[model samples]
Target chain A: MLDYPALAALAEIIRRGSFEAAAAALNVTPSAVSQRIKGLEERMGQVLIHRGPPARGTATGLRLMQHLDQVRLLEDTLDAALRPASGPATLRLAVNADSLATWFPPAMAALPVLYDLVLDDQDHARDGLRQGQVSAAISSDPEPVPGCDVLPLGAMRYLALATPDFLARHFPGGVTEPALRAAPAVIFNHKDGLQSRWVQKATGKRLHLPGHLIPASEPFARAVELGLGWGMIPEAMAAPRLRPLLPDLPLDVPLYWHVQRAMVPALTPLTAAIRKRAAADLRP
Target chain B: MLDYPALAALAEIIRRGSFEAAAAALNVTPSAVSQRIKGLEERMGQVLIHRGPPARGTATGLRLMQHLDQVRLLEDTLDAALRPASGPATLRLAVNADSLATWFPPAMAALPVLYDLVLDDQDHARDGLRQGQVSAAISSDPEPVPGCDVLPLGAMRYLALATPDFLARHFPGGVTEPALRAAPAVIFNHKDGLQSRWVQKATGKRLHLPGHLIPASEPFARAVELGLGWGMIPEAMAAPRLRPLLPDLPLDVPLYWHVQRAMVPALTPLTAAIRKRAAADLRP
Candidate 1:
């Protein structure tokens, strides 16, 4: 059997990113934390952490931490079932930035847990589940990872939008492929495919886009409003101040809720909450 | 010289995170893009990219990209001086979220460049410069990276804030060490030291803080406002709806603008704009 205390220490080090920070979080001396890891490493016959100034977990370390998280979650749920007044659980979830900015918060608010949110582009959020980095995820991919359940959470509609001034200046000839290729775009990040997908959907051709890259959801929307670029914005966050580049062609990305099957019992309330919020905010 | 077109291809591949995506951005066929990289790699005699489904840069690859960026910026500035109608340059920068959410956007707007922003904790932002991932960075550390000039940009004051209900429920006996240990906090992320620093300043003791981790500046503050947990909030974002736990013991983190000395001539307008906005928003 593994030393759970040492396992806990390993998880803390990865989460906090340093031996000293993890020591502070665990209320232990750095020396003690170091010793525990050393002993555990010796017992396991493998190195688990890369001891950088900002420490990082090796693959084995991450796997162990994932295991600990699952076990603790199960225990917490069991304790709650018995006592009815146990402390709130800690759930690490991967959610897209737009969802967090728009309709997701109410769902989060309904859960009685401390959240550790990992924000990724919706198209790639499922990678968090595949990599065992998150307990659950909100993703555009409907396909479930092995040992995970997928629940359709409806679709987030995106409109290709720009400010009035931006449209007047850049698309004086109307929203043509040439104008789109020439105009700047506000891209969320490298992983974000909404802009390219929207362009393809609207124009039926793939075009090279020059743009500003702003990663945050709010700022990406704000950049379009500031006349930096045109972008595909979630309909929920599409303010009246912005006008659509192609009003007839809105992209609706279907999102799914993926959770480890074992976690379903503990996470039913959150699932219900997510469904409730998505129903109101997402298009059919 | 050293195959500038091939280097541009490499940068695009890294930025877009896939060979196909890079090809789309460069308006080249994927096979042509592949040949350019192949020839470049043979010329350099070292691997430049980790060809994942989502591609990544090697250490040398990133260094080359940084070199290309600086060259492009200098050339763009020269072109503007001569003809004044050249295309906008792309400037990659690292900035702390709080500053971006509050005082930084105006500075960005004042500059005539397409921005690629990297968000990190204020304490860690300078690493982007040290690692050559960015030409400039907004950091809390006054010390400049080697070959960089640091300009003090005043300070962001923080207040230990919580909802009235949270205070009543969690700290019935006021903000003592025991109560602090028992109550949860809202932390920005692993690199965020504001809460620990504030707690140390207030109590002169290190306490293990149980908390929720919300990475975004707006969502982090919103977590505290939603009563998920108390957190150290930037004074600019501390809403009237929340009350300070210890009003007198505010933490002021001084910020600095770190720019590569060689790029300083091109960034003069941005520096002026940053100073102007910081003067209005940050505490002296």
Candidate 2:
């Protein structure tokens, strides 16, 4: 029996970072925001916010935020059921920058709703799904979350690429183990093994090479284009300026879409749209 | 006692995302990687990796990754002590996008090291430091972590701004709660409450407004520059194209640098450089 108004206030405070900001967003006085939170705390007998210049959620506050998210979803579902005129619902999703930058937006565009997108690596996105921070996720993980439905969305093809000048200077002998061993490579981050996998497959031997890592997707492609080092790029993201070194060396990374097992009817259209878009866009 | 080589192999596997890729990165065969991880697991008597199409670290493997980071730091310290000519050590840090886009890189440029940078929201950056996923973090947290020393880095001043056209169209009657409630605003993300804070300070009222959310820092600024909606922009990032709506309504967000209390001497220069640069660049 939590107070819905107070719970909304709690979520607003955590999201906006202060009672004052939450007050503004909710069209109430700062004192009102503080009072609601205090009332909620008194009822629960637990402190929800850690008082600071920019306030932070206590562990209890985090649990409350999650509850708010759940309540919002259920309320939206009920509203849709009661009125056909109810406007589109919001979807909070976890995605990667590369997907957001490339193919995912068009899929989402078909859905008529506000989107709260959290961008992170695919593995991290899966973690968010498991944590209930998001109702859905686009991830590299094929395994479904405990109460989620998983759909394979095909693969993003990455080609081993380098600028023309880099190829001429470093691999004049063509793609070989010795030459690759001596050349530097670009990576999304230390956790990226696409380049290493490509190198092993290309050279038929394991060889450690100096790595120049740039953590962002666009910068990584640009780093390769600028001749910082040879690396892999999604076929769709490969700048026109980049030329493939081993043109036939393509790595297909399979991606999956995971949706909550008990999804609301409002989201079915979105899932269909995503499935159709992914089928048309991703490499087989 | 753990085998250092096996531990290194385990870290590489987690970072690279696959045994084959780790093998290539370390100049060893896939069989060698498997053997090293197997031997390490047998000694520890716990599961390290969860096998799938791609492998992921079990919680134990994640702990091993943190241990790897610590061991690497200690080894670099020893190397520096034994030889003055040691190469620049790698420093893994989590930072806010605003700082990364502006003052922070120049601070790093003054240091002699390879960098592994993880960009996330400022509060989330602090969490990464707590999880031991990073060596240092630039955070909004004023208090230090249990074993960290905190330093004030002054404030990042942000101005609430809109294109002249947007201001004219949305607030022709001048800035007020009614107009604000009706007009759309841009936000870095749902979690970004900077705009809410500024609006309240400027309007002297609390009001919920429709929002246009873009998660990336550069894109969020660009959205403001493009007149998508009014939003707060860091003073340094405000392209000349953006004009301030309420010139006096500037928000000063105080920032802090949290460093491990037992920071090695090898990182002292970087810490000093960061402090000096922050002082020179940030508004006091």
DockQ, Cα level, model 1: 0.61
lDDT of 2 by residue, B1-284 (tens): 66877877786676666898788767788999999999888988998888654677776776566566665566666644574442334466777767765677656645444456667776666666676666778876787787677889989889988889989998999888778876667777656778778877887765666675568666567656656678888898888877887767789988888776655454677778878878988888
How accurate locally, in lDDT, is each candidate?
A: 0.84, 0.73
Find the candidate with the highest DockQ and give its number. 1
Native-referenced Cα lDDT, model 2: 0.73
Residue A132 local lDDT, model 2? 64
- Per-candidate TM-score against the hidden true structure: 0.94, 0.65
Model 2 preserves the real interface contacts to a fraction of 0.26
TM-score of chain A of each: 0.92, 0.86
Model 1 bad stretches (over 4 Å) = A79-88, A122-124, B79-87, B122-124
DockQ of predictions, in order shown:
0.61, 0.19
Model 2: per-residue Cα lDDT over A54-91, one tens digit each: 78778678667766665555566564457444223346
**Native-to-model Cα distance after best TM-score fit, residue A113 in candidate 2, in Å:** 4.8
